[model samples]
Target chain A: MSTLFSGQLLFAALVVGSIYVLIALGLNLVFGTMRLLDAAHGDIVMLGAYTSFWLFTLSGMSPLLSMLVAGALSAGFGAAIYYGLFRRLLANTQLSQRLEGNSLLLFFGISIILQNVAALCFDTTPRAYTYLDGIIRFGNVAMTGNRIAVLIIAAVLCAAAFLFLRFHIYGLAIKALIQHRQAAAVVGVNIERIQLLSFAIGFGLAGLAGSLLSMTEQITPFMGFPFTVAGFVTVILGGLGNLTRGMAAGMFLGFVEIYGVALTSPSLHSVLIYGVFIVVLFLQSQGLLGRRPS
Target chain B: MQPVPIRTSLIFVAVIGAASFLPQFGSEYVVAVALSFAMWVALAQSWTVLCGMTGYGSFGHAAFYGMGAYVQVLTWGTLSPWLSVPLAGLVSCLFALAAGYPALKVRGPYFVMLTFGLAEFLKFSIIGIEATLGQFSRLIIGAPSPNALYLAMLGLAAAATLITYVVSNSRFGYGLRAIREEEQAAETIGIPVARYKLTAFGLSAFIPGMVGAVMAMRLSYFEPSQAFDALISFNIVVMAMIGGSDDARGPLLGALFLIGLSELLWARAPQVYMIVLGALLVFFVLFAPQGLAKQLFGGARRRAT
Candidate 1:
């Protein structure tokens, strides 16, 4: 493992991690502030893929337009979930501790629905957009132009979201809410509005990631569940609700995953990733960069 | 179980007796249907014991099921079919032992995510193993006769039901229920929260493992996607949830209902089945999160009588 930490692997990790970052930050925002786990997040990414694929398939539109369209659509879906499912749960739930538990069921249901519907519409076979077929080389290493595009898009979006949380008026409120919801409320933050905003932003980012994913990977209705699970792992690695840390952790995980895939037999790739996840969990349950104990 | 009224006991006996003897009277199709229903009952019951009762929600229980199937397929060439169940159960129990401590250290969504991740990890590891061995070719095994398989599944289901019945009525069940209601308070009041949770999780994984192995034998093959699918966990979770998890009978009823519904959809409109399942799940989560049993039968509150 130590010997594998060369620049190439590190660079590969960065690219892979950036791909992960496209969706994880959104999950982090919702998980961190609202404590809602939105397990359907990966499905949103899958939808983004479809959005791009369909845009190309039907209208011959550019992937960039598809990205924006996907982002908007997913944000709408996220808002719908918040208003239709989450808002009801939040209002009905008496105990703060049990909210996420109850909400998880809703998200699970949503994920199922999303998968089945997408399957019905698109079928289960993987769908990939016919684009970004070029590669860029540096030194002795070569990477796909699609991978670079995904990396740049993911980083830029992550930075934009991080900045929003840092400097935007609503961003400060969200930050305050994540740090201390009760205090944030006392300080006159509109908690519900901000929560909805965060939720929408998270979904929007997921959608964006999905569009970017069209250029890099296969898409399927069922692809979301695994990514959602991995996203959760990323969230835990960076500490729950710690958005920026999630970025770093996402990269770290990408490195681990890429290197794990590289070092082990093809089948053992997932094993190595999971093995690392469990080990890290046992060593520091709080995550490498998380502030609060999950 | 409390000393039941003779009528209720008689009803129970009659129902199970009819089910156990179902293969004798029906075609192989009936046997197959019964087998699937029974498997769901067993899997859902095993899952509900820890997740439903404890409220920890083991979202990835299918991992145990998949692992059990994997273990069975790997070792079944030498071992007897009956023996594989216990072996798989033991292996899955051990995995729960290893994962539970680290996983249960967190609560709420984190716990759910950890369980989900563990299952995903198992799924990937299986895929990795398959890739390494280049064993994409299907396993060719002497599958049990449909009748024998049906009977075996019925037995497993009965065992699962019995386990849930006993556990739900026992002191251990009470402690688990306490944990579900409020863990920190339960710990403060001396519930041995961690120990109880681990025990619950281990117990939950065992029957599913057994059921998974049985499924492998029944299916006569073990593919990574089909065997270790995370969707199985989702189905079991949905079943446990929709039927309600507050009572021993919840999972049984839920599994029967969903499996029956699935069979119907599978027969008439296989494509629409998942769409319907998704719709039902959303409906249940939003409108009936207490599950149908809780809403219809007045579950735990009514159980006291």
Candidate 2:
């Protein structure tokens, strides 16, 4: 490929990778901290995209502002799901044994419901907006202003998340819960509040990523499925519950997919991404940065 | 040993007898639906043998099904359906054995994830091969007659049911159950946990492969997307879980229930069927974790009680 094409592809890869990093971060937080596998995380992402899309289309709001709205809404929805669905199931000892399987079916059903609702509302036609069509030129290479903005947002979010987790009281509480739920509870941590906050923030991150993705790509009801798979793969590659590792793995996957597409056919990008995942899993079952369970 | 209950024996006989004569009296459309339901029942039961009894949640069964479909397609073009279908099952069983060997080393969630990855990998490989090789020139497979296909499927389903019944009562079945309950304990008790798990996997794969082969023959077409769809795998698992994975009759009931539900919903409200199915799954996971079979069978009646 020419230098310009290569540069454009690299930039695209970074932007896409950043979105994955954002979503993976959220997934890692929820799954890592609560020890609950939320299969509906992708549906939350789709909700964010559709929410932003509708807002921009109906009220002439900027995508960035719409993203904030979407994030808040998703947080509310996440908390609601935790209270209404997960909490009840978590109470049952026999049910918890098959929680993963149950969660898969449960969230998958929710996903289908959300998708159908979107389809009924949006008419199943893929829609796009020209909110971020401007391009910034650097030498012979050109980059979309929207992409650059997304990269900046992603970087800021990642940095903010890292700082929050490392320094903040609530962040530490979340981590404490992840390490030892019983001990954290014994040490006067409100386990319920922490779980609610973590799930809300996790979903909020997914919503943010979804809004950013929609600015670059067309919005469809079924968009969540692929992104969910991508998020899952990233989490697995990064080591199940490690946030930093998930982000690193997401970026690694994004670059691999982008470069792999450029080198060969774009169709094989999934194969390449999943191929790396299988290899990583085979070699190190826990993943690159996943902690071994005691 | 407890004698086989007359009530249970009579129920089994009645169901089989009804199933055997279904094609003769049922309308063409009814027969078609019944055959389709039977096909899913077979696939679901196959999955139950491994996932329910052995505790190996193989998410890559679509790969085995796809392999069986392709094998049938490859053979039926040149050979007879009778010969090709069994060959498909054998091929799938071999593949399951090979794939399960490495996977059985891992336990719990890791095993599930690996199987999921393998299924996706197989889907990609099939699509890649189809793209690389011209679709028209690569393979030319003929379809079998629907009537013959229906009867063959019925026979296969019966055989699968019988095999499941035999295994559920056999020494091997006890070993499989032990592994499912506690792998370490089973190993300590000399249950050959790995071997029994592999055997379950192989049998599971074989049944689906055989059914998939018949399905391909009935459909008269085969493609990667159709053959290796993750949704098929999901549906089979859901059916087994819904009907009661632990019981032999559970998957069959689950399949029939889902098929009837899908057909009714699709006819009345095509868009809402999926939503309803999803809602039921979630509800069942939360409220009725034991599955329908457990509900029907009364949660394995304690002998003393």
Predicted complexes: DockQ each: 0.44, 0.54
Using DockQ, give the best candidate's number.
Answer: 2
lDDT of 1 at A159: 81
The most accurate candidate by TM-score is 2
What is the per-residue lDDT of model 2 for residues B209-284, given as tens digits with 9 covering 90 to 100? 8887888878777888788888787787668667865547877888888998888887787568767777777777
Cα error, residue B151 of model 2, in Å, equals 0.9
Cα shift from native, residue B277, model 2 (Å): 1.4
TM-score against truth, every candidate: 0.91, 0.94
- Angstrom error at residue B51, model 1: 2.0
Best by lDDT: 1
